[model samples]
Target: METKHIIITGTSRGIGFELALQFANAGHKVLAISRKTPQALLGHSNISCLSIDLSIEEDLEKVTQFIEHTWKKVDVLIHNAGVLLLKPFDQISAKEFEDIYKVNVFAVANLTRCCIPYLQKGSHVVTVSSMGGIQGSMKFAGLAAYSSSKGAVITLSELLAEEYKEKGVAFNVLALGAVQTEMLQEAFPGYQAPISAKEMADYIFNFALTGNKYYNGKVLQVSSTTP
Candidate 1:
Protein backbone atom coordinates (compact mmCIF):
# COMPACT_ATOMS: atom_id res chain seq x y z
CA MET A 1 0.00 0.00 0.00
CA GLU A 2 1.15 3.51 -0.73
CA THR A 3 2.04 5.48 2.36
CA LYS A 4 -0.43 8.32 2.86
CA HIS A 5 0.15 11.64 4.55
CA ILE A 6 -2.81 12.06 6.90
CA ILE A 7 -3.73 14.98 9.15
CA ILE A 8 -6.12 14.19 12.01
CA THR A 9 -7.41 16.52 14.73
CA GLY A 10 -8.66 15.72 18.27
CA THR A 11 -5.90 13.16 18.66
CA SER A 12 -5.22 13.64 22.37
CA ARG A 13 -7.66 10.81 23.07
CA GLY A 14 -10.71 8.86 21.99
CA ILE A 15 -11.31 7.94 18.33
CA GLY A 16 -8.86 10.56 17.14
CA PHE A 17 -5.99 9.01 19.09
CA GLU A 18 -6.84 5.53 17.92
CA LEU A 19 -7.05 6.69 14.30
CA ALA A 20 -3.58 8.19 14.54
CA LEU A 21 -2.15 4.99 16.03
CA GLN A 22 -3.76 2.76 13.41
CA PHE A 23 -2.61 4.92 10.49
CA ALA A 24 0.94 5.03 11.83
CA ASN A 25 0.91 1.29 12.53
CA ALA A 26 -0.02 0.71 8.90
CA GLY A 27 3.11 2.65 7.83
CA HIS A 28 1.39 5.92 6.95
CA LYS A 29 2.55 9.37 8.03
CA VAL A 30 0.25 11.00 10.60
CA LEU A 31 0.08 14.54 11.95
CA ALA A 32 -1.98 14.37 15.12
CA ILE A 33 -3.40 17.66 16.37
CA SER A 34 -4.94 18.38 19.75
CA ARG A 35 -4.56 20.61 22.76
CA LYS A 36 -2.22 18.07 24.38
CA THR A 37 -0.01 15.54 22.64
CA PRO A 38 -0.29 12.12 24.20
CA GLN A 39 2.85 10.39 25.55
CA ALA A 40 1.92 7.16 23.76
CA LEU A 41 1.96 8.78 20.29
CA LEU A 42 5.38 10.32 20.88
CA GLY A 43 6.97 6.87 20.76
CA HIS A 44 5.90 6.26 17.18
CA SER A 45 8.23 7.47 14.46
CA ASN A 46 5.44 7.63 11.91
CA ILE A 47 3.35 9.98 14.05
CA SER A 48 3.85 13.71 14.66
CA CYS A 49 1.72 15.56 17.18
CA LEU A 50 0.83 19.25 17.19
CA SER A 51 -0.54 20.85 20.32
CA ILE A 52 -2.78 23.76 19.37
CA ASP A 53 -6.30 25.01 19.89
CA LEU A 54 -8.01 24.59 16.54
CA SER A 55 -10.47 27.32 17.47
CA ILE A 56 -7.65 29.88 17.24
CA GLU A 57 -7.07 31.32 13.79
CA GLU A 58 -3.35 31.94 14.20
CA ASP A 59 -2.66 28.52 15.67
CA LEU A 60 -3.55 26.96 12.32
CA GLU A 61 -0.46 28.47 10.73
CA LYS A 62 1.66 25.99 12.66
CA VAL A 63 -0.19 23.20 10.90
CA THR A 64 0.15 24.70 7.42
CA GLN A 65 3.84 25.42 8.00
CA PHE A 66 4.44 21.88 9.16
CA ILE A 67 2.82 20.46 6.07
CA GLU A 68 4.69 22.80 3.78
CA HIS A 69 8.09 22.06 5.33
CA THR A 70 7.63 18.37 6.06
CA TRP A 71 4.99 16.44 4.12
CA LYS A 72 4.84 18.92 1.18
CA LYS A 73 1.40 17.48 0.49
CA VAL A 74 -1.55 15.85 2.20
CA ASP A 75 -3.40 12.73 1.09
CA VAL A 76 -6.14 12.95 3.68
CA LEU A 77 -7.31 15.58 6.10
CA ILE A 78 -9.70 14.61 8.92
CA HIS A 79 -11.60 17.27 10.80
CA ASN A 80 -12.32 15.41 14.03
CA ALA A 81 -11.88 17.93 16.78
CA GLY A 82 -15.22 19.09 18.19
CA VAL A 83 -16.54 20.65 21.38
CA LEU A 84 -19.79 19.38 22.84
CA LEU A 85 -21.96 21.56 25.04
CA LEU A 86 -24.59 19.62 26.91
CA LYS A 87 -26.81 22.23 28.47
CA PRO A 88 -30.45 23.19 28.35
CA PHE A 89 -31.25 25.30 25.26
CA ASP A 90 -32.82 27.99 27.36
CA GLN A 91 -29.84 28.12 29.69
CA ILE A 92 -27.08 28.06 27.07
CA SER A 93 -25.22 31.35 26.82
CA ALA A 94 -24.28 33.08 23.59
CA LYS A 95 -20.59 32.75 24.33
CA GLU A 96 -20.98 29.05 24.99
CA PHE A 97 -22.77 28.51 21.69
CA GLU A 98 -20.24 30.51 19.70
CA ASP A 99 -17.39 28.65 21.40
CA ILE A 100 -18.73 25.34 20.17
CA TYR A 101 -19.13 26.69 16.61
CA LYS A 102 -15.60 28.01 16.68
CA VAL A 103 -14.16 24.55 17.06
CA ASN A 104 -16.78 22.44 15.32
CA VAL A 105 -17.56 24.65 12.31
CA PHE A 106 -15.17 27.56 11.84
CA ALA A 107 -12.09 25.54 12.61
CA VAL A 108 -13.00 22.95 10.01
CA ALA A 109 -13.42 25.61 7.36
CA ASN A 110 -10.24 27.44 8.28
CA LEU A 111 -8.14 24.32 8.39
CA THR A 112 -9.53 23.05 5.14
CA ARG A 113 -8.75 26.34 3.47
CA CYS A 114 -5.18 26.14 4.70
CA CYS A 115 -4.92 22.59 3.38
CA ILE A 116 -6.32 23.33 -0.08
CA PRO A 117 -2.97 24.18 -1.59
CA TYR A 118 -1.49 20.96 -0.32
CA LEU A 119 -4.31 18.65 -1.33
CA GLN A 120 -3.84 16.94 -4.68
CA LYS A 121 -5.99 14.73 -6.83
CA GLY A 122 -7.37 11.71 -4.95
CA SER A 123 -7.07 13.51 -1.61
CA HIS A 124 -9.98 13.21 0.78
CA VAL A 125 -11.37 15.54 3.40
CA VAL A 126 -13.47 13.85 6.08
CA THR A 127 -15.49 15.80 8.60
CA VAL A 128 -16.63 13.90 11.66
CA SER A 129 -20.16 14.84 12.61
CA SER A 130 -22.84 13.44 14.92
CA MET A 131 -26.11 11.60 14.31
CA GLY A 132 -27.87 14.34 16.22
CA GLY A 133 -26.92 16.68 13.38
CA ILE A 134 -28.98 14.74 10.88
CA GLN A 135 -32.34 16.22 9.99
CA GLY A 136 -35.28 14.15 11.31
CA SER A 137 -32.97 11.93 13.36
CA MET A 138 -33.64 11.22 17.01
CA LYS A 139 -33.14 14.43 18.92
CA PHE A 140 -31.73 14.62 22.41
CA ALA A 141 -32.08 17.31 25.04
CA GLY A 142 -29.13 19.57 25.96
CA LEU A 143 -27.54 19.32 22.50
CA ALA A 144 -28.88 22.46 20.87
CA ALA A 145 -25.46 23.98 20.39
CA TYR A 146 -23.54 20.79 19.79
CA SER A 147 -25.97 19.27 17.31
CA SER A 148 -26.42 22.52 15.42
CA SER A 149 -22.70 22.98 15.06
CA LYS A 150 -22.31 19.46 13.79
CA GLY A 151 -25.09 20.08 11.33
CA ALA A 152 -23.30 23.19 10.08
CA VAL A 153 -20.14 21.24 9.30
CA ILE A 154 -22.18 18.70 7.36
CA THR A 155 -23.43 21.44 5.06
CA LEU A 156 -20.01 22.98 4.89
CA SER A 157 -18.48 19.71 3.69
CA GLU A 158 -21.14 19.36 1.04
CA LEU A 159 -20.50 22.84 -0.29
CA LEU A 160 -16.76 22.26 -0.23
CA ALA A 161 -17.16 19.06 -2.21
CA GLU A 162 -18.98 20.94 -4.91
CA GLU A 163 -16.44 23.74 -5.02
CA TYR A 164 -13.45 21.41 -5.12
CA LYS A 165 -14.91 18.78 -7.41
CA GLU A 166 -12.98 19.93 -10.43
CA LYS A 167 -9.76 19.71 -8.48
CA GLY A 168 -10.34 16.00 -7.91
CA VAL A 169 -10.30 16.42 -4.15
CA ALA A 170 -13.22 14.76 -2.35
CA PHE A 171 -15.15 15.92 0.70
CA ASN A 172 -17.41 13.80 2.87
CA VAL A 173 -19.04 13.80 6.28
CA LEU A 174 -19.42 10.97 8.76
CA ALA A 175 -22.32 11.36 11.17
CA LEU A 176 -21.28 9.00 13.91
CA GLY A 177 -23.50 7.30 16.45
CA ALA A 178 -22.86 6.67 20.13
CA VAL A 179 -19.30 5.69 20.87
CA GLN A 180 -17.78 4.98 24.25
CA THR A 181 -15.39 7.86 24.94
CA GLU A 182 -14.62 10.44 27.57
CA MET A 183 -16.86 12.88 25.72
CA LEU A 184 -19.75 10.41 25.73
CA GLN A 185 -19.27 9.64 29.39
CA GLU A 186 -19.27 13.31 30.24
CA ALA A 187 -22.28 14.00 28.07
CA PHE A 188 -24.45 11.10 29.18
CA PRO A 189 -23.35 9.81 32.54
CA GLY A 190 -23.61 6.02 32.99
CA TYR A 191 -24.86 5.56 29.44
CA GLN A 192 -22.91 2.70 27.86
CA ALA A 193 -22.38 3.10 24.13
CA PRO A 194 -22.66 0.05 21.92
CA ILE A 195 -19.36 0.70 20.12
CA SER A 196 -15.87 1.53 21.31
CA ALA A 197 -13.78 4.50 20.16
CA LYS A 198 -11.17 2.23 18.64
CA GLU A 199 -13.81 0.42 16.63
CA MET A 200 -15.10 3.67 15.19
CA ALA A 201 -11.57 4.78 14.45
CA ASP A 202 -10.98 1.61 12.48
CA TYR A 203 -13.93 2.38 10.23
CA ILE A 204 -12.85 5.98 9.79
CA PHE A 205 -9.28 5.06 8.97
CA ASN A 206 -10.27 2.87 6.02
CA PHE A 207 -12.86 5.31 4.82
CA ALA A 208 -10.45 8.23 4.93
CA LEU A 209 -8.17 6.40 2.51
CA THR A 210 -10.55 4.96 -0.07
CA GLY A 211 -14.06 6.28 0.42
CA ASN A 212 -13.51 9.14 -2.00
CA LYS A 213 -13.20 6.68 -4.83
CA TYR A 214 -16.84 5.74 -4.38
CA TYR A 215 -18.28 8.82 -2.76
CA ASN A 216 -18.05 12.59 -2.76
CA GLY A 217 -20.21 15.21 -1.06
CA LYS A 218 -21.88 12.36 0.83
CA VAL A 219 -22.84 12.05 4.47
CA LEU A 220 -22.59 8.58 5.90
CA GLN A 221 -24.64 7.82 9.01
CA VAL A 222 -22.42 5.47 10.98
CA SER A 223 -24.76 4.51 13.76
CA SER A 224 -26.23 1.17 14.75
CA THR A 225 -28.90 2.58 17.02
CA THR A 226 -30.95 5.75 17.30
CA PRO A 227 -29.40 8.34 19.56
Candidate 2:
Protein backbone atom coordinates (compact mmCIF):
# COMPACT_ATOMS: atom_id res chain seq x y z
CA MET A 1 0.00 0.00 0.00
CA GLU A 2 1.26 3.46 -0.83
CA THR A 3 1.71 5.69 2.18
CA LYS A 4 -0.56 8.74 2.35
CA HIS A 5 -0.83 11.64 4.73
CA ILE A 6 -4.17 11.26 6.52
CA ILE A 7 -5.78 13.86 8.79
CA ILE A 8 -8.26 12.59 11.40
CA THR A 9 -10.06 14.62 14.04
CA GLY A 10 -11.24 13.60 17.58
CA THR A 11 -8.41 11.14 18.01
CA SER A 12 -8.00 11.30 21.77
CA ARG A 13 -9.94 8.03 22.07
CA GLY A 14 -12.82 5.92 20.76
CA ILE A 15 -13.49 5.56 17.03
CA GLY A 16 -11.08 8.35 16.07
CA PHE A 17 -8.20 6.82 18.01
CA GLU A 18 -8.87 3.42 16.54
CA LEU A 19 -9.03 4.88 13.05
CA ALA A 20 -5.65 6.53 13.52
CA LEU A 21 -4.14 3.26 14.75
CA GLN A 22 -5.48 1.28 11.82
CA PHE A 23 -4.24 3.77 9.23
CA ALA A 24 -0.83 4.17 10.84
CA ASN A 25 -0.48 0.39 11.06
CA ALA A 26 -1.10 0.27 7.32
CA GLY A 27 1.97 2.51 6.75
CA HIS A 28 0.12 5.82 6.35
CA LYS A 29 1.27 9.00 8.06
CA VAL A 30 -1.64 9.80 10.38
CA LEU A 31 -2.09 13.24 11.92
CA ALA A 32 -4.51 12.75 14.80
CA ILE A 33 -6.14 15.78 16.40
CA SER A 34 -7.99 15.98 19.70
CA ARG A 35 -8.41 18.31 22.62
CA LYS A 36 -5.86 16.35 24.63
CA THR A 37 -3.15 13.87 23.61
CA PRO A 38 -3.79 10.27 24.42
CA GLN A 39 -1.00 8.56 26.36
CA ALA A 40 -1.28 5.40 24.28
CA LEU A 41 -0.27 7.35 21.17
CA LEU A 42 2.76 8.94 22.80
CA GLY A 43 5.53 7.15 20.87
CA HIS A 44 3.93 5.91 17.68
CA SER A 45 6.26 6.50 14.76
CA ASN A 46 3.55 6.69 12.12
CA ILE A 47 1.20 8.87 14.21
CA SER A 48 1.52 12.52 15.19
CA CYS A 49 -1.01 13.79 17.70
CA LEU A 50 -2.08 17.44 17.64
CA SER A 51 -3.89 18.84 20.63
CA ILE A 52 -6.63 21.15 19.42
CA ASP A 53 -10.21 21.63 20.49
CA LEU A 54 -12.13 21.74 17.23
CA SER A 55 -15.00 23.59 18.94
CA ILE A 56 -12.76 26.63 19.18
CA GLU A 57 -12.86 28.59 15.93
CA GLU A 58 -9.37 29.96 16.48
CA ASP A 59 -7.86 26.50 16.83
CA LEU A 60 -9.29 25.40 13.49
CA GLU A 61 -7.11 27.87 11.60
CA LYS A 62 -4.06 26.88 13.62
CA VAL A 63 -4.66 23.23 12.85
CA THR A 64 -5.08 23.92 9.16
CA GLN A 65 -1.89 26.01 9.06
CA PHE A 66 -0.01 23.34 10.99
CA ILE A 67 -1.09 20.66 8.55
CA GLU A 68 -0.18 22.78 5.54
CA HIS A 69 3.28 23.52 6.92
CA THR A 70 3.97 19.98 8.09
CA TRP A 71 2.37 17.80 5.39
CA LYS A 72 1.73 20.27 2.55
CA LYS A 73 -1.26 18.17 1.50
CA VAL A 74 -3.74 15.72 2.92
CA ASP A 75 -4.66 12.59 1.00
CA VAL A 76 -7.52 11.69 3.30
CA LEU A 77 -9.38 14.03 5.64
CA ILE A 78 -11.68 12.39 8.22
CA HIS A 79 -14.07 14.61 10.15
CA ASN A 80 -14.78 12.26 13.04
CA ALA A 81 -15.01 14.61 15.97
CA GLY A 82 -18.52 15.15 17.42
CA VAL A 83 -20.41 15.75 20.63
CA LEU A 84 -23.58 14.21 22.13
CA LEU A 85 -25.63 15.99 24.73
CA LEU A 86 -28.51 13.85 26.00
CA LYS A 87 -30.98 15.97 27.86
CA PRO A 88 -34.66 16.73 27.86
CA PHE A 89 -35.56 19.13 25.05
CA ASP A 90 -36.81 21.72 27.49
CA GLN A 91 -33.80 21.25 29.76
CA ILE A 92 -31.22 21.54 26.99
CA SER A 93 -29.54 24.83 27.60
CA ALA A 94 -28.51 27.26 24.86
CA LYS A 95 -24.91 26.76 25.84
CA GLU A 96 -25.18 23.00 25.36
CA PHE A 97 -26.72 23.39 21.90
CA GLU A 98 -24.02 25.85 20.91
CA ASP A 99 -21.29 23.55 22.13
CA ILE A 100 -22.63 20.66 20.10
CA TYR A 101 -22.96 22.75 16.96
CA LYS A 102 -19.49 24.19 17.36
CA VAL A 103 -17.87 20.78 17.30
CA ASN A 104 -20.25 18.85 15.10
CA VAL A 105 -21.12 21.41 12.46
CA PHE A 106 -19.14 24.65 12.51
CA ALA A 107 -15.79 23.03 13.17
CA VAL A 108 -16.33 20.56 10.36
CA ALA A 109 -17.15 23.33 7.94
CA ASN A 110 -14.18 25.37 9.05
CA LEU A 111 -11.74 22.51 8.71
CA THR A 112 -13.06 21.52 5.29
CA ARG A 113 -12.88 25.08 4.07
CA CYS A 114 -9.27 25.38 5.22
CA CYS A 115 -8.27 22.11 3.56
CA ILE A 116 -9.87 22.84 0.19
CA PRO A 117 -6.89 24.72 -1.21
CA TYR A 118 -4.50 21.98 -0.17
CA LEU A 119 -6.65 19.03 -1.25
CA GLN A 120 -5.63 17.47 -4.54
CA LYS A 121 -7.20 15.04 -6.94
CA GLY A 122 -7.95 11.56 -5.55
CA SER A 123 -8.17 12.86 -2.02
CA HIS A 124 -11.10 11.61 0.10
CA VAL A 125 -13.13 13.66 2.59
CA VAL A 126 -15.15 11.50 4.98
CA THR A 127 -17.50 12.71 7.67
CA VAL A 128 -18.63 10.50 10.51
CA SER A 129 -22.36 11.01 10.91
CA SER A 130 -25.09 9.06 12.72
CA MET A 131 -28.24 7.08 11.95
CA GLY A 132 -30.16 9.81 13.70
CA GLY A 133 -29.11 12.06 10.88
CA ILE A 134 -30.98 9.87 8.45
CA GLN A 135 -34.54 8.71 9.34
CA GLY A 136 -34.82 10.28 12.80
CA SER A 137 -36.15 7.32 14.76
CA MET A 138 -38.01 8.07 17.96
CA LYS A 139 -36.13 5.49 19.98
CA PHE A 140 -34.22 8.20 21.80
CA ALA A 141 -35.84 11.23 23.36
CA GLY A 142 -33.00 13.51 24.44
CA LEU A 143 -31.04 13.38 21.19
CA ALA A 144 -32.58 16.36 19.39
CA ALA A 145 -29.51 18.59 19.52
CA TYR A 146 -27.02 15.84 18.68
CA SER A 147 -29.06 14.32 15.88
CA SER A 148 -29.77 17.67 14.22
CA SER A 149 -26.08 18.51 14.15
CA LYS A 150 -25.22 15.18 12.54
CA GLY A 151 -27.94 15.69 9.97
CA ALA A 152 -26.36 18.99 9.04
CA VAL A 153 -23.00 17.27 8.63
CA ILE A 154 -24.50 14.74 6.24
CA THR A 155 -25.97 17.54 4.20
CA LEU A 156 -22.66 19.35 4.20
CA SER A 157 -20.85 16.29 2.88
CA GLU A 158 -23.31 15.90 0.04
CA LEU A 159 -22.97 19.54 -0.91
CA LEU A 160 -19.19 19.29 -0.76
CA ALA A 161 -19.19 16.28 -3.08
CA GLU A 162 -21.06 18.25 -5.69
CA GLU A 163 -18.83 21.29 -5.31
CA TYR A 164 -15.56 19.34 -5.44
CA LYS A 165 -16.40 16.52 -7.81
CA GLU A 166 -14.87 18.34 -10.75
CA LYS A 167 -11.62 18.56 -8.83
CA GLY A 168 -11.64 14.78 -8.16
CA VAL A 169 -11.96 15.06 -4.41
CA ALA A 170 -14.33 12.39 -3.07
CA PHE A 171 -16.74 13.34 -0.28
CA ASN A 172 -18.82 10.88 1.73
CA VAL A 173 -20.51 10.40 5.07
CA LEU A 174 -20.46 7.36 7.33
CA ALA A 175 -23.68 7.03 9.31
CA LEU A 176 -22.68 4.67 12.04
CA GLY A 177 -25.03 2.83 14.39
CA ALA A 178 -24.32 1.82 17.96
CA VAL A 179 -20.64 1.15 18.55
CA GLN A 180 -18.61 0.41 21.66
CA THR A 181 -16.90 3.71 22.39
CA GLU A 182 -16.65 6.17 25.24
CA MET A 183 -19.46 8.15 23.67
CA LEU A 184 -21.60 5.06 23.45
CA GLN A 185 -20.99 4.30 27.10
CA GLU A 186 -22.12 7.76 27.99
CA ALA A 187 -25.27 7.42 25.95
CA PHE A 188 -26.17 3.93 27.10
CA PRO A 189 -24.72 3.23 30.50
CA GLY A 190 -24.86 -0.33 31.98
CA TYR A 191 -25.76 -1.85 28.63
CA GLN A 192 -23.51 -4.14 26.65
CA ALA A 193 -22.16 -2.52 23.50
CA PRO A 194 -23.22 -4.31 20.34
CA ILE A 195 -20.26 -3.34 18.18
CA SER A 196 -16.57 -2.83 18.76
CA ALA A 197 -14.64 0.31 17.95
CA LYS A 198 -11.89 -1.70 16.25
CA GLU A 199 -14.40 -3.35 14.00
CA MET A 200 -15.88 -0.03 12.90
CA ALA A 201 -12.44 1.48 12.43
CA ASP A 202 -11.28 -1.38 10.24
CA TYR A 203 -14.37 -1.11 8.03
CA ILE A 204 -13.97 2.65 7.59
CA PHE A 205 -10.26 2.43 6.85
CA ASN A 206 -10.78 -0.26 4.25
CA PHE A 207 -13.61 1.67 2.60
CA ALA A 208 -11.52 4.82 2.34
CA LEU A 209 -8.61 2.94 0.77
CA THR A 210 -10.77 1.13 -1.80
CA GLY A 211 -10.61 4.18 -4.11
CA ASN A 212 -14.10 3.44 -5.38
CA LYS A 213 -15.94 6.29 -6.99
CA TYR A 214 -19.28 4.66 -6.26
CA TYR A 215 -18.99 5.76 -2.62
CA ASN A 216 -18.55 9.43 -3.44
CA GLY A 217 -21.42 11.54 -2.06
CA LYS A 218 -22.89 8.38 -0.57
CA VAL A 219 -24.09 8.08 2.98
CA LEU A 220 -23.04 4.56 3.95
CA GLN A 221 -24.79 3.25 7.02
CA VAL A 222 -22.98 0.68 9.19
CA SER A 223 -24.68 -1.40 11.81
CA SER A 224 -24.27 -4.85 13.39
CA THR A 225 -27.12 -6.26 11.32
CA THR A 226 -26.28 -4.54 8.02
CA PRO A 227 -23.10 -6.46 7.25
- Model 1, residue 46: C-alpha shift (Å): 0.3
C-alpha lDDT values of all predictions: 0.96, 0.86
Clashes of 2: 0
Tens digits of per-residue lDDT, candidate 1, 1-227, equal 89999999999999999999999999999999999999999999999989999999999999999999999999999999988889999999999999999999999999999999999999999999999999999999999999999999999999999999999999999999999999999988999999999999999998999999999999999999974
User: Total clashing residue pairs per candidate?
Assistant: 0, 0
Extract clashing residue pairs from model 1.
none
For model 2, name the residue pairs that clash.
none
Write the residue-wise lDDT of candidate 2 on 157-191 in tens digits: 98999999899999999888888899878887976
- Per-candidate TM equals 0.99, 0.95
Q: Cα lDDT of model 1 overall?
A: 0.96
Highest TM-score against the true fold, candidate: 1
